[model samples]
Target chain A: MLEFDNTERTNLGELGEFGLISYLTKAVEINEPSTLKGIGDDAAVLDFSNKKTLISTDLLLEGIHFDLRYVPLKHLGYKAVQVNLSDIYAMNGTASQITFSIGLSSKFPLEAVEEIYQGALIACKKYNVDLIGGDTSASVQGLVISVTSIGFADEDQIAYRSGAQEGDLLCVSGDLGAAYVGLQLLEREKNIFLENPNIQPDLEGKDYIVERQLKPEARRDIVELLAKIGIKPNAMIDVSDGLASEIIHICEASDKGCKLYEDKIPLDSMTYETAREFGIDPTVCALNGGEDYELLFTIPQADYDKIKGSMDITVIGHITQASEGCQMISKSGKVYPITAQGWNAFKD
Target chain B: MLEFDNTERTNLGELGEFGLISYLTKAVEINEPSTLKGIGDDAAVLDFSNKKTLISTDLLLEGIHFDLRYVPLKHLGYKAVQVNLSDIYAMNGTASQITFSIGLSSKFPLEAVEEIYQGALIACKKYNVDLIGGDTSASVQGLVISVTSIGFADEDQIAYRSGAQEGDLLCVSGDLGAAYVGLQLLEREKNIFLENPNIQPDLEGKDYIVERQLKPEARRDIVELLAKIGIKPNAMIDVSDGLASEIIHICEASDKGCKLYEDKIPLDSMTYETAREFGIDPTVCALNGGEDYELLFTIPQADYDKIKGSMDITVIGHITQASEGCQMISKSGKVYPITAQGWNAFKD
Candidate 1:
């Protein structure tokens, strides 16, 4: 028998629905001047000035989006909020408030719900936003978490994939494909555990990649960083769906072409090595693997020097006129047109 | 075989997602100048001028919120949107935009999703709001629809349940008990069909009550009418949960007492008859059965003369001091304290 450390435990029923909500929203900080009221009312209050408020929603199902057998509930909740916020960030706005609609299954105890709330509250505090209001219901199947994030932006400051100019420099934030590689590693270990339950599956040296998959952060810093540098991206989209697919989207929406350099693609060391061990191409994984939650944007060539040296930014390619078409130049100098190998829940 | 008309057909595939969204939003008219933008973009843009924005969300799941054996999909879609807007109306604000998130079962063809959209679009138009952005994904179990609505109100104009004063007059809009009775009628027909599919649903002469259940409108008109009369409610809440339960909420929030009259509770003639046929107490159903989507509010006595003869207004009670406690005066002259009989999804 193995000793289990269960000393740190609490019951959710100790705090009823209202109490739990109050506890979670205690730390939310209002950064936007437009946020008139954060939490603790029938609804949140927002003053949008003369600017229009933007809102977007996304729902993540437990078994469908992640396997609880591998994901901790805390990380699941944190990642859910982050993913929704990424959409608002992609739209070039600062998230001000969110509504979380949850459908919880009976299999989950109330304690699990509180832990999820703890993580969500932490994210709200970190992002300086509020958990306004949402619906909670019963679902017979797996847990369903739907989050709607509201944001505000000056009309001219808003960015869209359709706005890329003909000769803009295409760039991305940090690295890509680590989360996908992390998923491959987790799946392999789960299989090994199934074969031998007594042995702790080997995951000794994969901290970076695993963390990327479990608790990815939205590039809120990137939004502020761009503003600081006085560079409004010609076009922008968050890389939730791998690098190549996102590039193609920019091309399609902007009616422009892109030529990317293989040598310029950024991949962490662990992601590259893990892809080899899994018998997959590192470049292909970087091009098609998703859930990185990084931003990809295009800035004019004149502004490149202002951002290229920044720690997390990368200049990967340049946008071309519409007639040129989109392609990638390989290390060996062969050009290949980009394709949308992005994740589609409908098809896969 | 009996001749049946199958000629009424609509193909959703012919109208792609964008086309369907456009077709439905075409009828939406925005009367409020604060609505900077509606639909068509990454999000519905709303500029609330000097007023702060209010937002709320709710989810209605099939087989949980409604039994499709009785409720039609179109009505379900319409209700999903209206319920969220009701939250805004409850806050004494005008709804500007709504985002709809839907989870579809694999068994449903694309047309079914479009039908739901058609209903939602019609509701948006009627409310003079915009359809912003939402997530669509597959559900392993059944259909689930979630809607988040945004509205605006001046800091001074925003009314909450916590703002009621002692001695204020309690008022309600339109009639009650109709939706509950309509539901009973639908359930009876559903039972008849299950016992024998050969029987047709004889739903004629029940239009008023049936429509109450299927397509209950948000009391936006009543909100406007109150504004016209310069009667700002001291406190307000929408009666989605029975009138008694909602009264209890107002009491608990405001820390006030109320004296309500059973005879003053409005009920339609058809609804009263249907409740008798179902062997359920009409008053009880009207007071405790859910989903009327009507406005319940309290106003200062000084403004009573301005609204006394208005067609849609019903003065039901008066607010008493907290020590007096919440009670209802029956038609038989007995008084009883109001208890919470609101729908509790968590209490399965």
Candidate 2:
């Protein structure tokens, strides 16, 4: 588990938009050879040769997807771009360009919009893509941001959840459940503030989890890292939903089953600590909490040695025969079938 | 002035989602040589052996961009896609794919989302592109749809708003004003509906104007028509915000002035008649009314013959030296400088 102190609580307003964007996307490494430009123009340029273009879009509304009283606009902007980019990345293609459509209430000053743009533009520059165009309008409620991303890859290079092999080795990127736990902390702090506006909420020693809630970066690098090691995931998906939910997608699509090791799960130290404080099982948070933005994938075991010692790589499970059913092995040697506890926007 | 009667109303629920989309995008003609497929796949394909990729996006919220009290969802969906595609078309590039991100309210059902997609898919087929991917979420208010379009053109073939040459002939494709008049008619009918909910709308003779309002098509054909005639516009933009507004964009981008002939402005006969009935000047509607989705461009006069006698071509203006100032010449030989009365979502 990774651990960090939450002593630094910078006011997002001080960074401005451009500064925030530059600060956050400063480490994104572009790996796709087809990416003509990653993040700095009216649009990202791509050279797909003769393949068909692929584009996808998504919209995240404030108060609906998040609560602004707890979430920062800069992180919100970053997550918005990450969520859309995940779709493209899931298709095993690199996003070349993106368009941002933003809706702000009259109550929000222009500075708020600028801060959002800062996060967006920073993601663009880090991904090496351009901010081509989008629409802006007024909303009666909270802020709404929609981003559409474009990506390209050869037909053969694309991987879908439908193509996993029964014998494939299932793998996942980085840690899980941090973002959800981060949200928990933010919500807790907000409650404290609501109880008394003058209270400086106790966010001490919770920086990692809080950052996870505020600005979770997409695993664009994992895709590249795997490619660099000459490994192509048979079936891959970004973990926008919980790990169990996404695993079910792979199973349903590939018509296969899986067994995961509970003790082998990756959990950042702060996330585990907070989950314990909240009286929730850390494993449950790891399994049910969403928005990790990690990449879950399967690969042939023949190449397992190549990825084993790598940073943040966890071998939590293995794919089983279809009839085996999806199950997880508990640390106490208990076997439990996974159930869908997905976050459904429709279930008000 | 073109002339027509005003008594037509159509309920969108009649066609549902699939039916409405099929009805509107039935006539889109693909002209770009690099287009691999149009509007039927997870993503549109583009043969990019000789060109660079460009993409853009936009989001339109009901009540903000259009009043559902007047505008139907079918048309709203169609226009949503058209507007994004128009951005690519404005750059003298051919759109190859689109991604739609929709935020639907609980008031809407699954059928409504399909209806919106139907409109989007119809445009995809018409424009010879693909519906790549998109995200859907619940909204707290009315519907909001965001669309991102991907396009391509040779590096040199790409046209920007800044490329208008002095003395170039300013040209417009298709007729205008009908959409604006149609909007006015719909507003009146909406008022009547609010006054008496049981009285069925009196709609019979306003098919042309209503179609203009309910199912406005983008001028994709013009892109092909000009290509077939071997003419690339020196500068181009889709007339979304009315002629006066679009012309101003050209003037500002090109750092040049423009002259327009009021006598040459094209207006549908139905639109002109409706304007008179409403006691509004037909030309004013043409200049200030938006959502025409037509191409307003400038080409060197050397290619004037290429555009002359072309179907739906209008020689409404010419590019002038910067010192000449931007103004329009009326039939009585009076000059009135153009002002951007087009919509500004930010203004109070």
Candidate 3:
């Protein structure tokens, strides 16, 4: 629970939907020239001129997606926006607006909702995305956040999942599996705190991993950087469901296969050390652990040299023909087929 | 509950998120030339060159917005799309595409989810809108549907709530209070069935009311009719959260007042009879009993003559100066002030 500046806790019921929305969005200012109308209307109006529009939506459920026991409301809010914005970036588009619809039970006070909105506002400010229209309803139980992000790009520049060529080079921006490792740490600490209420969490030097889980950043810079260098990816996907799963998605969609190297999979030193401590393989963590929010894209063999030595990018593998199947090449050169059976939100 | 078509059932868990989405959207055809990309991509790409883009979203919680005991899942799906499209129509825009995000519990079978998807597909087909992209995830409890509708219109054709002027004629498309009356009938029948499972629902004579409640249609035809007649509304809103609430919204936004006539309020004869049978005032139901998905607009008095004789429209009232306040004048010459509060989802 977050410490409230004011001890007077006002229930959400005190302010109905209209009052609550007005109160929270009172200070919201629309600066985008494209945005003709923002909140306070039946629908927001935007003029994208000749540019193509990009749209994506994500729904996050409480208990199913995040546990509020350790995850702060503000970070959850920020992470929610970041997660949705990542989808637009994956399409090589510029995110310009987002609508956040959150349903909460009676357990959340007005202050809590404000905290969540504040964090989301911070994210909108940082990304230069306008907070447009949204709906807030009463939840029967727990919190539910549904974010819809709107973006724009040229028709020729938009990346599709089925555009990868058979021999295209597969590259991923930023390291993988950090957020998944962070989740394990948070869950472990949450269990400890529940067992012994007096013991403080031992998160002394785990800021990097913890932040990765709590407030992951989308790789908008990677998209902009590639564009600046006149390189357009043939196929692209955001690593929201682990590197292996995303690569499989790209392969299946493009009617191709891929060879991801285990040694080439990017894993931070901290992630490796923590995985070893937990008696887990860092490679498996990178493979199965999701929510990395990095761009995993494929480019032509000729264009690979342009991005070869980028500090933030790692050349994980190359695409293969469909008959070859998606496989992972181990350090000892053993092959393993990739599967699409990951990130099951339904799996109890 | 809806009767299952077959004795055999496939659980939603069996297919997982990816398989379920793939199975459901396999037959989704994209006919819109503007739709560059559809369901399989991270984000849908749309080309709306030289047009203003419109966006609207709605979040509906299962228990609050619907009851599965009587409401068919397929109808729920269709109604969800209709409700969202109503907002876009209210803005005088043509809804082109929508993104549906539904979170459901394990209780729902794959067949049940398919039913809902089919209903939404039916609506999409009828409206000539494409189901571009969506997110399907597991819920901890009942169903949660969040739909974001995308639309486009010329700048001059777009309407806003804050454009009404004094002496503008207030009008409504279609009759009101039918949906609320339908709700009462369904609830009574639901209770009767719950008390004795052997007793079937008695919906023989209430076909119109039941359909109004279960499958409300947006006033897209009215919008087309108005466009054909070359009469542009000064201000407009969709009647979702009752007539009174919507009128209040228009009045507040436009900085104007209204004089709604009791006798002029369009209530179908069936709605009137049903409201009396339930010991509720038909006028009150029309005023405050929500979910009617009709268009409520204010047109300049000069344009009133052109729309006065339209069968689907009613000249309910006229806009007044702000100081006059929003009031409903009775047939017996009484006046009542309007307020902006209605539809408390959490209220028992």
Candidate 4:
């Protein structure tokens, strides 16, 4: 868990809105050639030329989306950018720019805000995306972050969720369930910390799961690798609301059903072992646990040969006729209908 | 003042996030030819072709930016879109698409959200812009709205705030200060209502100011008019932050000074009278009170004749050498330095 130092606190009111904005964004450097105008303007201007411009937005509310008690502000900032960029990459586009609007109460110090921006800047630098423009305002309660990511892709390179065809192989990048299990670990640590303030978080041996929860990366590499191998996914989506939920989305959009294999579902040993320790089924966690920023896509059967040998890619399912219904064939050879048990914000 | 009907309240939790989003966006129709793909996809794709893309975002927090006691949800939603689109118009670009992400607590009913979306749809239809994409999430507290507007303009036609020259004439579209004074009226009525719950609001003849405050429109017409007249602004900004603040921004960005005449400051009669009624200086209100959403721009002195006869356009001032400094010449011949006392969110 991250601990905030209160010794060097500077009130946000002292800088005012414009002063604070200028201070936070002073180091923003435009790296994209398409960015014609960035900060200090009414709007950011971009020259996409003949390429199609791609835009996606996500809203992260403090209590609903995250808990700052265990999550570091810098990690939160980085994760927010990753979550939005995942959408752009899911479209098979090159993520180029993002407008990050934030609303925070006066309870936060200037240094706290600086840490958030620092993390965002680091993510932007790594992803080669420009922080073009955004809005900042004081909120009445907890912090709210709204990120709108912009990208560009040729017409032929763009992939939509509705493009999936029957018999197409469903592939996912990286491993799943780690981020979800990581959150469970964080929540448990948070409860222990709240019960006893002096106890250090016992997250020493769970670095992989903890990092997956705190600083998840978007599958920009998966999009690039596909382009490099000359394989375009018929349908694509980022695994945000778990594999089951995202599969349902693709199926519903494409008017097709999917047959996912329980045995083929990739799970990290740490995630599986951690889930078992918590008395949770590892398969259920892999199916319903969300927040894995991996790319879940469907490629033609002909293209499977190119990705089969790749360690990062896993073929977990295949598209089926709509009449067949979405189902998961368990390791025991029992088939069960897939249901969207993913995280629901409105659930009490 | 707007009164929400609580007689028929449907809990937002019933719809969940996806259900709520689908319910709200069921009627969204794509009107922009540039928009290749809208909502339902990972990202909205827009084919801007050779035109440069203009992107701007604004975040509005419930308690910080508005008071729900007097501001209607529909009007609030409409004003939010107008506020973002004004930025695009400020750049002499045509707004064609917007991604509106909103975060609201469970206290809000489904109908209230529908009212907000209804208002947003009305604005989108009027502006000929597409509600391309967005994110919906449950907030821990009050409503949070973030709108990212996208537009397009030819490379040569786009106006930058740093393009102003010494000899350029400062021009403003539409009258000023009405919205600020209107807000004063609403606040007074709100306080009265809070103290005496049985009393009705005494806003008999304040329709103009009230409407200005509740539902201000972006000056898209002014941008179109300038284009029609074949005049391009050297520098431009929207008057979301009072005239003085916006003027200072233009001056600082262009590395020039400005001479704004006090008498030339456009003010509606209702705004002037209301300011006096509140025992406030109308000029100060025009200089400090914001949310006018009018376009403030600078054109070459030679292009003055084309706009001089237009009633909508007002020649308020002229650009000067950097050493002259940005100043306002009062009617009494006294010169005062322009200061940005505009709405600062950080101010307590």
- Put down candidate 2 lDDT per residue, B50-127, tens digits, no spaces: 677877766777767777665655567787888888877777777876767777664465555555677777777777
Q: In DockQ, how does model 1 score against the reference complex?
A: 0.44
> Which stretches of candidate 4 lie above 4 Å from their native place?
none
Candidate with more favorable, higher lDDT: 1 or 3: 3
- Taking all chains together, each candidate's TM-score versus the true structure is 0.91, 0.86, 0.98, 0.99
Top candidate (DockQ): 4
TM-score top scorer: 4
State the lDDT of candidate 3 residue by residue for B1-348, as single tens digits.
457776768887778888889999997989877788888889999989989999999998987788888889889999999999999999998999999999998777888898899999999999999999889999986899999999999999998999999999999999999999999999998899889989998888889988999999988998899999998899999999999999999999999999999999999999999999999999988899888999999998889789878889999999999999999998798998876558766444
DockQ for every model comes to: 0.44, 0.33, 0.76, 0.86
Error of 1 at B19 (Å): 11
Alpha carbon deviation, residue A285, candidate 4 (Å): 1.4
Q: Which whole-number lDDT from 0 to 100 does residue A53 have in model 3?
A: 93
Sort by TM-score, top down from the best: 4, 3, 1, 2
Better of 3 and 4 by DockQ: 4
Best by lDDT: 4
B-chain TM-score of model 2: 0.85
Can you write out model 4's per-residue Cα lDDT over B237-282, one digit (the tens) per residue?
9999899999999999999999999999999999999999999999
TM-score of chain B of each: 0.90, 0.85, 0.98, 0.99
**DockQ of candidate model 3:** 0.76
True contacts kept of 3: 0.73
Instruction: Report the Cα RMSD per candidate.
Output: 3.7, 7.1, 1.5, 0.9
